[model samples]
Target: MDGVKKISLVIPCYNEEKNITRTLDGILEVFKSSSILAKYDFEVIAVDDGSKDATWAQIVEYAKKDNHIHGVRLMGNFGQSCGYQAGFDASTGEYVITVSADLEIPLENLAKVVELLEQGYDFVNTNRKNRWGGEKKAKSGMANKIISRVSGVCMQDRGSGMKGFSRVLVDNLKFYGDMHRFIPDYLTVYRAKMTEFDVEFKDRDFGVSAYKGSQVFWFYRSSYYRLWFLGNCVSYCAKTVGVQYWG
Candidate 1:
C-alpha cells in the first residue's frame, strides 16, 4: 500500500468514439479526487478492437497528447473479450482493472475494488444495483440468474463491465469463447480467493449495445459446453479418488 507500483486500467473500445473522452475524463477525475494520482502511478490502456469508426483515431490522438494514455489497434474486430485480453496482455501494473468504454460503470467504484484487493481478495467483481432500465434490466436479471444457477456461483451480475483482478490472477487466466462472463466462477474453481462490491452503474450515453437475440442462442450453447467441461472435471477427480482408494 505504501510503495504500490502503477495500476493499469484497460478499456476495450469497439465503436465508442462518442463516449471515450467522457469515460477517460471520469477516470482521471476519480484519481484526482482520491489523491491516488499523488500516491501511486497509474495509466490507461485503450484497445481499439478494430472499430470501423473514429474510435482508434481518437484513442491515438489522446495517447499522443497524454503520456499516460496508451492505445492498441487490432487488425480486425475480435469482440470485447479478446479486446480486453489484448489490453491485459499489454498491461504492466501491480493491479489491473477492466472497464467499459460506454461510461456506464463509474470509475469511483474502482477505489473500493482496489481496497478489497489490498485487503487480500485475489479477484473482485462489480455488482450493479441499477443496470439501464425496463426491458434491459429484466433481461440482465434473468440472464444473471441463469448464469449463477449453472455455474454454481452467487453473482448478481455476470456481465458487469467493471471487474478488477490482481496481477497474479490476471496472469493466470486462460480465456476462450465468451469465458470472460465466467471469470469469477473459473477463478473460484482454480482456488483463487474472490470478492464482490457494489458499483455504480449508469445508462449508456452513446452507441447501441452490440448484444443481439442471436447472441443469446450462442450464450446458451456456451453454457452447455461449460456443463460438459464441469462434468468431465468431476469424472476425472472421481477416477483419481477411486484409484487412490483401490491402490
Candidate 2:
C-alpha cells in the first residue's frame, strides 16, 4: 500500500467513550463491505479533544492494534473545530472525511461522498433528511436556512458532521471559532466544486449531545462574522477599483 492514494477518516471525540467504539466499528464495516479498502489505502484518525473518560485509552488500544488507525490526544478540551484541525494536520491522505464520534451520521453513506469526489467534486457534504429515526427534520433547519439565505449559499444541511473534502480543500482551511459550520461556504469561496447528498442520521444512544443552548447563540454570532467577512471582501474590491480610477 506504499505510495498509494489514501482516504483519511477523522473522527473528533470528546468524552464519547461509549459511542466511539461503535462508530469506529461501523466505519470499518462500511469500508470493508464497500471494498473501498482494497481499492485504496486508508487511515482512521481519531482526535480526542481532552476527553476526561476512556476515549483516549480506547483510541490508543485501536491504534496499537491497527497500523491504519492513529490517535491524537489534545492537551485540553479545545472544541470540535480544533479537534478537526488537528486531525486534518495529521492526515496524509489524498482525500479526507470528517465524521462525528457519536455515530449520528452513519459511515455507510461515505460511499456516496466518495462517489461524488470520484466524479470531480472537491468537497461533498451530507444532508440528513431525518434525524433520530424521526422525519421531524434537523433541529438546526431554520437557523441553517437563515444562514444560507443571508450568505446566498444553499445547502440542505449546514453544520452536518458528515463531510468529505479533497486534499486541496483540506489544505486551505483555517479553523477559528466554529468555522467548521461554515466549511461548505468556505470551500465554495475558494472555487472548489461542491455537492451535497442525502444521508441517514442515527440518534446517539450512549452519550448526551454536546451542543447546548449557549452554542446555539454562538452559532448565530458566528454566522454574523461570516457575513461580515464576505462583506469586507466586496468592500475591498470596490476600494481597489476606486483607487485605480481616481489615481
Candidate 2 residue spans exceeding 4 A from truth: 132-139, 212-218, 230-247
Top candidate when judged by TM-score against the true structure: 2
Output the TM-score of candidate 1: 0.84
Q: Ten residues in a row with the worst lDDT in model 2? A: 238-247
**Root-mean-square deviation (CA) per prediction:** 9.3, 9.2
Tens digit per residue, CA lDDT, model 1, 1-247 = 5576788899988989998988887877788898644456788999887788998778877777777788877777767767777777778888899888997777778888788877888888888777556766666667666767777777777677888888987676655456676776666666777777777777787889776434543575457447436423322311001100000
TM-score of each: 0.84, 0.85
Compared with the true structure, what per-residue lDDT tens digits does model 2 show for residues 1-247? 7777899999988999998888877877777788655577888999888889999888888777777788887777877777888888788898899988988876778778777888889989888666533222333665667677776678877667888899987776756556676776655567778888888777789989876434554576555556647423322311001100000
Please state the error at residue 130 of candidate 2 in Å.
1.7
The TM-score between candidate 2 and the true structure equals 0.85
